[model samples]
Target: MNTQTLEKLREKLHDNANILGNLLVETFHYIGLFAIGAVTAWAGALTCWEMLHQGTITVDDILLLFIYLELGAMVGIYFKTNHMPVRFLIYVGITALTRYLISDVSHHHRPDMGAVYISAAILLLALAVLVVRYASSRFPSSNTPQGANATDDPERAEP
Candidate 1:
């Protein structure tokens, strides 16, 4: 084919690909929602049973519950808003990792070095969370401004 024909064909292929990609994304989104519902129901049932039978809940168990809750909430938010809050996911990940470290510390007979390493990792993660929170607060997002827009600058509009 000639160059013009090839370009047109490529554009058509690109448009079709984009449409297919969007449809696949929507399908996966629905599948994810279904999976989240199933898993949340299962986890809620399990937690209730354990609470009733055990008569008490441990910190680790509570942490696990929070993880499940976060997962459910994240999925719900996606369904409602058609977007996921990445910051919330990061928080959930940090909580999960911290819970795992705490559980390991309580259950394991590892050496001091292992404990130190785990502590270091937790500290680093904590620092990361703090940095992200601070940066977001300071800069804000494009939709949300940190300060009022300048309306007194007509000359600056040309730039």
Candidate 2:
């Protein structure tokens, strides 16, 4: 009935709304990640099966499978630590470019600039991965607010 009681009730209601919103967001996030992971794994399996049924699997097919695998791994890491490793993406890029190079060479009877460009891309991606690794280690994020890397000792990161 008093102004103080009314103010307390309003604050409580606001706090409850925020909690409910956060809970809903987290639930949806998990659901989406699970769905994506399941579908990617299924597709990878299906592709492998189709390749086997066709009676031949090339190196490019194998590399394509690795992309699917990396995607699944990225999803798993997200589920486990809620942090996506940038390195995984870089690895996928490298694999994809290598596959492109293989495809161009196999499809074209003669060596072309397309294959050369793909090779260059792969090299650049590999170097980018190394640079990212160096930077992360050299200037590691000591304060992980989410506590995801709580066990990671910055001192042990020194090579």
The local distance difference test score of each candidate is 0.71, 0.80
Q: 55-152, model 2: which lDDT tens digit per residue?
A: 99999889989999988988877787677778788888999888887787888878878777788888899898888777776666655544445245
Q: What is candidate 2's local distance difference test score?
A: 0.80
Taking the tens digit of each residue's C-alpha lDDT, what string does model 1 give over 1-159?
Answer: 899999999999999999999999999989979898788869978997998799997788888888788777777767765656565566677778778777887888564677677677768777876776666555555554346342222111111
TM-score of each: 0.65, 0.84
Candidate 2: residue 71 Cα off by (Å):
0.8
Q: Which residue runs does candidate 1 get wrong by more than 4 Å?
A: 1-21, 109-111, 138-159
Total backbone collisions for each predicted model = 0, 0
Residue pairs with colliding backbones in model 2 are none
